[model samples]
Target: MTSGKPISSHLLPLDPRRRRSLAWAAGLALLFPLAW
Candidate 1:
């Protein structure tokens, strides 16, 4: 079996999509506070 370090390193390639979704979710959360 592979080591845990290699498994965590593989997740590094997901940065772009993850960052974009995170920004979008943050924006929606901010809008919610204004709407209330």
Candidate 2:
């Protein structure tokens, strides 16, 4: 959990719109393996 904090803080500077799109892409990436 300690290592995760730095990454979360690092991404906090990004715009909300960018973050939302990034999350959507990550979700699709995760689902793609299962869908195949």
Candidate 3:
């Protein structure tokens, strides 16, 4: 979609549970690369 949605909207999803899970996943991803 060519809609000009703000990037922050995607970063912070509407679902609280999903947002928390995404934060956890993002943290794990960052840590995984460092632990490699």
Q: Residue 7 in candidate 2 has what lDDT?
A: 58
Candidate 3 segments exceeding 4 Å error = 1-8, 11-13
Q: Write the per-residue lDDT of candidate 2 for residues 1-36, one digit (tens) a residue.
A: 586477567778988888778778878988999899
Q: lDDT of each structure?
A: 0.73, 0.79, 0.72
Clashing pairs for model 3 are none
Per-residue accuracy of model 1 over 1-36 as CA lDDT, tens digit each:
765467446656778788567658868988999999
Error of 1 at 3 (Å): 31
TM-score of model 2 (CA atoms): 0.67
Which candidate leads in lDDT?
2
The RMSD of every model to the true structure, in order and in angstroms, is 8.6, 2.7, 5.2
> Which rank order by lDDT, best down to worst?
2, 1, 3
TM-score of each: 0.53, 0.67, 0.60
- Give the 10-residue window scoring lowest on summed lDDT in candidate 3: 2-11
How many pairs of residues collide in each model? 0, 0, 0
Which is better, 1 or 3, measured by lDDT? 1
Candidate 3 structure lDDT = 0.72
